[model samples]
Target: MTAVGKQIREAILATGPISIAQYMQLSLTSPVGGYYTHGQVFGRTGDFVTSPEISQMFGEIMAIWYILHWEMMGRPTKTRFVELGPGRGTLMDDMLRAAKRFPQFFATIQGVEFVERSPELRRVQMEKLGCPKESMESVKDKNEPDTPGSAVSERYGGISVRWHTQLEEVSVESDCVPMVMAHEFFDALPIYKFEKGTSGWSEVLVDVDDSTTTPAPPQTTSARLAGSPHSSASDNSSECHFKFVRSRSVTSNAAVILRDPRFDSRFDKGDHVEVSAESARVMAVLADWVSQNNGLALIVDYGQDWTQGDTFRGIRKHKFANPLSQPGSMDLTADVDFSYLRLAAQGKAKCFGPVEQGKFLLDMGIQARLKQLLQATTDKKVQQDLVDCYKRLTDPNSMGRIYKVLAVLPNGAQGMPIPFAPPSKEELNRPKVEKIVRK
Candidate 1:
């Protein structure tokens, strides 16, 4: 019963219940059966492997944390090395091969956008960035031109490269700086699941049951009414049929049953819940284009550190499944709240380390880039598969304690490089059940 669950049960029998972020944006960008628009989900033959496909010492320690945040932003003659969702461009080819050891930060980098919206993964990021269409027209020659019937850009390329489809059409130039980056790009943004029953919250829909239309045999139901009287009906699945309405004055009236009746009535289980309000309004338009241009951002994903509950998930070949078994064919994600990304960088940016991508790649040196790739590969089983990909990227049992690492800057900025050290206030006020009892 998959072909994205028979096209989401014929779009809920031709329109009726759809919004778990519009069924995760048509199940991951629908340009025709979207599970990332048709396959090759990303290396080791797909399904999971990221962290720049797990090595090249994780993009050479994220190009030494973007050359210490481009020398803490002061070395900017022109900067703008963006990257939101640039997959298959292997972390921008290991961040331009670790920014060719600062050939003046690759000649002040000046251009390399790429927000991306799949023209077959933008021709696999223009054949893995052999770059050139005059360096992708030097980011459309820094925007605004075109007056008399514009085609803009007359010339440039002191190193450019563009391609955006969002991040508000990315074409910045004025006071440059804007250095952004994303790795697991905010956990594929799209989540909304609530479950706290009784009669106060019940939003988890995905309806289509007038007898399953002309295609039968996928029937499943549950919604046994009868509320109040200290309500309670926690487990009697058909997915979820909550009824926990207890309020002996009020300390537990919870009622939010949404477990997928497609996307039950959009919202109402304590409202304020959203997944990708276009990824927090494209991270508040990249923190107001790096706080009115003087930039810095760095994401890296797999999230948490916000509060509330539910962190929707799913994946396929590499395991953990049943995100409603096959709708748009698997791979839906969530958990990058980082406190609504620091309230979408509203204080005009200055967030740091949502930390724990194995302590920010072992504080950005990944064990000295894994001993310089085991002293340039001598091969004892290729140094035990690069010491088992650095213990699956710094093992706290894998993907280093559920992956995370955020950064934002643009407030009293100064030549970057301070990798880890900002996560306190008792480590961001502890308790989400101590991060699920420390996972």
Candidate 2:
């Protein structure tokens, strides 16, 4: 077993079976050897590349979107530019660079907030951002009045930077509106898998074995299975035989995993599945924060339209790996159940997009951005590299298809550019597609 696996085994032995959320939380945030805590996980040498790493164009387009929203908000005198999980601050750097195009927009930006837990990463972000020392502040509380230039003295003309461990910790002074963005943040939350069985819906849980190693085990239940038909089956015979089996028989044999079950009630026996209450709770908190603070948030991640399906996945060294292995060393992620997220945000904030990242980027003028980059580059090799990066980011065959984007707006706001239109009934009725669409 790997070092991470050994540590996880020891934990499970001491604490018994842990919730999927707990497992994922430790895997990414543990102080010593967790994925984000131990080493760098970005850039060319990292486990995987994000949109910001792929091309600056991604962040530039996002900045344009933010500018549009700022305009919609009537260009508030003071606007909080916040980013959740600002990894290495590349996205923020690109955003700031792009925002410079609109001097008025930049001028209206009073503070920058980053919701991150890693001190090491905070150091890297500060160094890269060139933010002045006095500008580095933390949010106080909702009750506190706006400090304005207190965090940054009159001498400091640069944007003030604030760090908070959680969204709730960020102080929202009166009269200052907030605009938050999270790129590939929601998908990183842990997901629970559930399978429909003759008995009911059974949850997939990680349990410690006699050897003290934890492995996913299916719990039996009798709840009706949720979600569309399974997309692809590794075992061909199972797919061919599924039609012949009775509903109960099919449910018994079907290995479907529900992403969330916090709101689910009905169930029987022999049902197998999973859920992510923790993810839902996180979204609720975010939505509540935005609504209460007169702010908006945009979430960009890889997920499907709030539809029923399994999209749990893991990555290590840029390759797909078993989530059960190397507990704290690999990245475990799941498709953000936009449907559930939308439900969670209902009545609190306005939700938009949940559209594919491909469509979102295309709509944001990635093609135009590419042309500009091509014109600026003189070397043939360098031009080709830029072209390749553009393709990797916006090509339907690449990140475009699997990854998705969603936006949340403060309730009652208008005039923002619509990222995408809802899919038509015909489109929804089309045959199911595999969750993982690899190049």
Candidate 3:
């Protein structure tokens, strides 16, 4: 078992089973032993590959998208370009480089801010993005004031790259357009899973049983002695596991589960539904930010418009694994429901697209970009590699159909942004998926 796994196992044994959200939180962000707290987790060497790492053309196209959107926003003199969870900062690096072609648009931006939680990832981002490392850690939350380590500005190619752990820390001037991007971010937010029962809905929890086998690094064995009451005397073979249990009572919110449009009527007993309160909260906060600042945000991730099933799973070494088996040693993620995201942003901002990523990229001229790169390169192997990457990003069997893009702009903003068309009639008729049934 991993060190973090033992910690989690001990928690469950002592305090009873934990909510899926709590389990995910500790697994991904434990600060001391979280999967993301240390080491490299991106690109070929990482657990999984993101679109930005697939091809430079993806980021370049996004640069064009940003440029067009900035123009649509009247090219505000002072704007902020913020990226959430900027892994290694490759996308931003390509984006800023492409923006150089339009000097006016590039110069109009006053700051390039990154919102990240991992100190290790932030260092990687700084190195890859040509931004200098901060002398101290930034303020931890939005409500907190600048401490000794708060976001001091650093520049790369004349663009200031400010680092913050929370969105609220990135200062926005009055009327300054905040162009925010959250590529492959929402999926990482912890989600709550509820199983439909004959009586009602029950929350899913992680438990320990004989089938559960603790994963290894050798040191994790000591974790059992560190806290769990079921120490060496008990069967050492027991492993972390998953199970479902009913809550004490249906709260006012849980009473509304049947009404949530995210789940279809087809769901019967034992059907599972996952909802991410953290994702919705982030979306609400983002909508509020855009609404207040007259800004825009682009969200891209692998998910469906509406979903009903267990999408939560773990990824280790680019392969799937049982999430409960390897706490704090692998990446845990769930499919994002773009429908809920749109609903969360409603009234405060105009939500657009949740369009297929392949369609969005094609519409944004990825083909032309690919051809341009192909022509520039004379090497056969490089040409074939580029083609393969292009196909991987656009092919229906790959990321094309599974991944989606969403846009949120200030409520009264006129016209559609680039790569997003006016809403289709079918999309117009779809019912909005309201907030999740609070656990």
Give a tens-digit lDDT track for model 1, residues 22-46. Answer: 6677778876577886637876566
User: Which structure among the candidates has the greatest TM-score?
Assistant: 3
* Cα error of candidate 2 at position 145, Å: 28
Instruction: Provide the lDDT at 380 for model 1.
Output: 91
Stretches of model 3 off by over 4 angstroms after superposition:
133-155, 212-266, 423-439
Candidate 3 lDDT, tens digit per residue, 284-334?
998988888888888988877875456677666555556776578677888
Local error of candidate 1 at residue 125 (angstroms): 0.7
Give lDDT per model, in order.
0.60, 0.65, 0.74
Which prediction has more favorable TM-score, 1 or 2?
A: 2
In model 3, what is the error at residue 206, expressed in angstroms?
1.2
lDDT of 2 by residue, 1-439 (tens): 5455566667777875555656677778876577776547776576667888778999999989888877876788888788888888899888888987898988887867888877667766775677555455533545422222113323224667767788887886778888889887877776665554555454454654444433331121100011102211111111010000123222321233332353234333433233556667778888888888888888887666544334454455555445655666566777666777888888888887677777888888889988998999799998897888777776666677767777887777664446667778987796543332223
Candidate 1, residue 392: the lDDT equals: 77
Please give the RMSD of candidate 2 to the true structure: 9.1
Worst 10 residues of 2 by lDDT: 236-245
Q: What C-alpha lDDT, on a 0 to 100 scale, does residue 166 get in candidate 2?
A: 80
